[model samples]
Target: MAARNSAPEKRPGLISQIKTLLKFTKDVYPWLPWVLIGIIVAGIALGVGLGFLIPPVALWSIILWGVTGLMLGFLAAMITMSRLATKAMYAKIDGMPGATGYVITSGLGRGWHADETPVGVNPKTQDAVYRAIGRAGILIVGEGAEGRLSRLINEEKMRAKRVAPQVPVHVMYVGNGEGQVSIKALGKTVKALPKSISKATQAAVIKRMDSMTQGMASLPIPKGIDPTKVRAPRPR
Candidate 1:
């Protein structure tokens, strides 16, 4: 009980976390000097105009200016980081296998889980597999080489059956290779799972897997490899 309470206590304050993230991005690439410049200019201009119109609103006009400046700065920071994050994701996974799966799991919200499955072929067949077990059923996706991913996906289905035998399982091969689903179509693929599995079954499956997976230590990440860089690729 104490440990569970401590977990919640340890979560960072929301505003502080957002500020910390903004600072970290500024530390990383320093990619948006111009955006910051524009923000300062715009904030100053807006604050000056507003000050002239609403004389009594701000006790000290300078304080209002500073507040306005911070708001504009934050907005600018958001735009810069959003674009950089997208480009960084592409750069990180360009030559790696299972890249699409990374994008889906990271970009999508809850009810979806993903992991790398390097079943065969480092140069081609490595796959990023994803699963969503919901009111519908279990939807599995393998994104990588088309030819080998099918077999790998089938094996995963068999494994899931052993884990939760009653859950209906559906699979898709996410790739442009023959008889495969393309990367961009991943969300649509998942949205199509049959509404066969019940809410109770989904909850049971998650509980069972959570218990089974507990107490295992996470693998150490490779040197100089950012977590973002390993997005869709399975470890080789």
Candidate 2:
């Protein structure tokens, strides 16, 4: 018998990834290309201008500076694209139930331990509360009307407080309503909370909370957007 042949799976190349990202971003933001071009140009001009300030500028130095500027311009463009891509993603998922959980699960940077599945959810209204533990202590993020989520948020808050009496518990609501955080800003808001607990304390709180909430019945979250497909590329 002939030996079986197999082909290895291929991941998208960097260039391909950039192209896909550009297309995705462009769909949501029509002026993305122009904005990126302008940002890149500005970055290049700034980098080359700084290079000219160096002592004893020569032809070689000018060429090197030009190259450096070009690289910096690309880097700036990438960063800008990443941010815009994130905004576009949030816009796509905004107002959908469980968006808060999706964002928390995607990431809130390092040192964050978030429960992607909401700890408290209202099946009737699709309101929910998500929890996260970090140096900032406990974050309780709620999606749904503030009035409707008040009791749910309070219950989750009380439960967290019971598990970790000393740990700080912060609450935030995600929506377009007054005083609610936008989906795009949810991660930033969570990360910006004042650090009130040490790493050890954070770990302890997470442990206690996990053990306490373990085996609790999960509520049915409204299905719509897939969190996996809603992720934005991170900036290098």
Candidate 3:
């Protein structure tokens, strides 16, 4: 049986991350030149804004503008990159057996505990519920066709409530159909939930859930797709 460790993978250095991020920008937006131009213009504008606050001396002005422009440019790149990556990645994994779980788990950032594998999966419908513990209490991300997850959601909720009945168990559905959240906004949407627990409580929840699900089998990723490399640039 495969191990079920859920630690966040180590990220490469900032330089390497920037390269990967920029490469993604290029791949997803073929109009690379336009993006560069836009960022450059934005950068220059930011630099000009800062120049007003600083002295008019040539040396200081030059340095300040250079730094400001660079930072703004990188900021623009990261924002655009994340949006494009979200669209591309979600489009690729949408409607897959465990895509909702995959997207939710991968995109969650710090201050939360998330597992890439589903904590509860329905054999008949291929529905899966991915779990995360954070300031918002326990969240169950239900991924399947819209309106088809009542049974799975109820079962998973019961399982979660059985262990920690006091903790809130919120369910989020992922799909293009009505009443479902879009994949592109999955991470942001989850993070926006009201905080219901403290850091200590969140950790306790994770520890308890860990013990309960440690031996559970992993949910399957669809064939021929690599979730880790899904954000990588594709061949032209």
Candidate 4:
């Protein structure tokens, strides 16, 4: 009875979500035809295979294969939508000093304890080092203008060493410069680090890492700007 009563509220929300997702994809890529064509081609291939495999196929069997193909196409469209949403997201926030840290603790999966405030920031140059602690251990990511990140990374290293000398500290730079890794690749770079501690140990180390957040400069760093939030991205 209670479930039936909530159906009205639930359906419009679901419809609204679908509409928003479709709109976001349409606006960002503006190449929906290519995706549609690819999905249709895959669906048709599946239908053709099903037609060949079936015994004494009738109208019903044909309809079933068609429906199955449509379902597969729908799933493909969802995956395409997700990819486009992610690309659109990174494009908006990529170069900011806090971008590396923002993506890490939010986009990266659980088991990570990442700080929201950056560990090091040069008010003038905007060069900054953001911190995160996880099963992989302490990560210090630096981003700013060319040559600025490297020096900030060095400064942050010394501070981290002072606070927790025994814990492993990894440094990463986000930019297109000589040695810097791209923004989108930040998650992979962090995960690739040696697993320096267990989950329980990660908590304790993260607690100690709180000391590194002291005296961080305030910058106009943006937070929680998910590109997919055309409205319905957050759920009740």
Candidate 5:
């Protein structure tokens, strides 16, 4: 009974972890479909070779087949879904105020839960600055005219601080202009951070930020984008 009950308790954590890893895989390989196919073929080839290399390894073959197949399936799904997710995210925010910032931050910082939130919108022009929520803190990324970005960043920062005071906040202006964080280097910038920080620290940062930004949610998924239409994973 204890073993039975423990199995159920352990399953959710295992599943969620697999999901999180898959999400990162998708983000890293958004444009690689053939790579997924290659992985499946390779996994099968390896599995077959191992099965034959050892004499009458039928039991071992079955176990290896299942494990290899599942991993390859995840790789294929990650490839298809990563591109789909990136495109979907881009489509929703493209041409909106702070779109570039949103996209850059979306791809930045591995191992941290990042969210792009629309907190302030200009009623007249429909322009907006998105709050980029990450482990480091809340970054108010401005997307409109360069001249107006400072004000927008400030306002967004103030709003974010009211909710999450403990989290250190940074305001960044995204563009090619001087003193701004360029879009191309966005991934490099975030990834360059020291890996010494433990996952617990990152989680605590996110928790504190969430506590501060209570009630805030991500912007609605854009119309006409079917989240379900992602490419099918290669059959295992």
Candidate 6:
């Protein structure tokens, strides 16, 4: 008998991936197709203009430049589509509860340890606090009205302080209101924090904090939206 073959499944082809991305972005951004076309046209124009400035405009030179322009145009369009798709995804989930949790888990890049589950929640008000530990130490993000989120944020901060006394704990709320960070800016804000802890220290802090909250009851994520199903494509 032939030996059993074990191979990883192939990822979707590039054309298929682009189609999926285009469909998703178009749904959220109605003007995406036109915007992409404009970007591609501009890129091609720039490339061809550069070619014309370099030497005598021969037929071969024009063809070469035109092909180069077309390739560059597509490249620029793909990049713009990727960024717009990301923004559109965030906009789609902006006002939903647990959106912060979703961003924390999926939006933030590597070197950050965070869970999609909020560490503190107010069942009555549906307000919650999510936590993340990185080189910046601890980040506590609250979702809901600032007033209702205060208690939850405070409680989570205190828990972090108690578990890792030396580690710094930063708090911020997610919303369009005063003193709150918008969902689009959440990842940027977290990444901007000064790195105050080493990788070893970050690991220790996370382990200690996890142990402290291990026994606490896990709360159900707010209803009306499923964040896991809505993911932004990772940028190249």
How much lDDT does each candidate structure score? 0.57, 0.83, 0.73, 0.69, 0.55, 0.85
**lDDT for residue 65 in candidate 2, whole number 0-100:** 79
lDDT of 2 by residue, 1-236 (tens): 98777878887778888987888788799999998889778877776777688856776777787778888889888988988897788888999877888888775976899866888888888888888889998899888888998999999988987888888888888888888899988888887788888999988888898888876876565566678777655532
- Candidate 5 Cα misplacement greater than 4 A, ranges: 1-98, 101-106, 160-166, 193-236
Q: How do these models rank on lDDT, best leading? A: 6, 2, 3, 4, 1, 5
> Which tens-of-lDDT digit does each residue in 1-236 have in candidate 4?
45555444544475576666666566667786578678877886787578668966877777788778878886776776767766755665667546766677676678677755566677776666777877777788877765666677787688778876878888777887788888878887777777877887787777666654544445444343433342224211
State every prediction's TM-score relative to the real structure: 0.56, 0.79, 0.68, 0.78, 0.43, 0.88
Error of 5 at 236 (Å): 11
Candidate 6 residues lying further than 4 Å off, grouped into runs, are: 1-10, 46-53, 234-236
Writing each residue's lDDT as its tens digit, candidate 5 over 132-234 gives: 4555655566555667556667776776567556666666655567876665555556555445435565576567656755766554422322322322222
On lDDT, the leading prediction is 6
Q: Rank the candidates by TM-score, best first.
A: 6, 2, 4, 3, 1, 5
Best by TM-score: 6
Better of 1 and 4 by TM-score: 4
Model 6, 1-236: lDDT tens per residue?
Answer: 99877888877777777888888889899898998889788877876787788788776777788778888888888988998888888888898888888889877788899988889888888888899999999999988888888778888888888888899999998999888899999999899999999999999988888887788887778764587567754433
Off by over 4 Å in 2: 1-9, 37-72, 234-236
RMSD of each: 7.9, 4.0, 6.8, 5.4, 9.8, 2.9
Pick out the ten consecutive residues of candidate 4 with the lowest summed lDDT: 227-236
Give the distance in Å from residue 134's predicted Cα in candidate 2 to where it truly belongs.
1.9
For model 2, state the Cα shift of residue 104 in Å.
2.0
**Steric collisions counted per model:** 1, 0, 0, 0, 2, 0
Considering lDDT, which of the candidate structures 4 and 6 is the better prediction for this target? 6
TM-score of predicted structure 1: 0.56
The residue ranges of model 3 lying beyond 4 angstroms of the native Cα positions read 1-23, 38-83, 123-125, 215-218, 222-225, 232-236
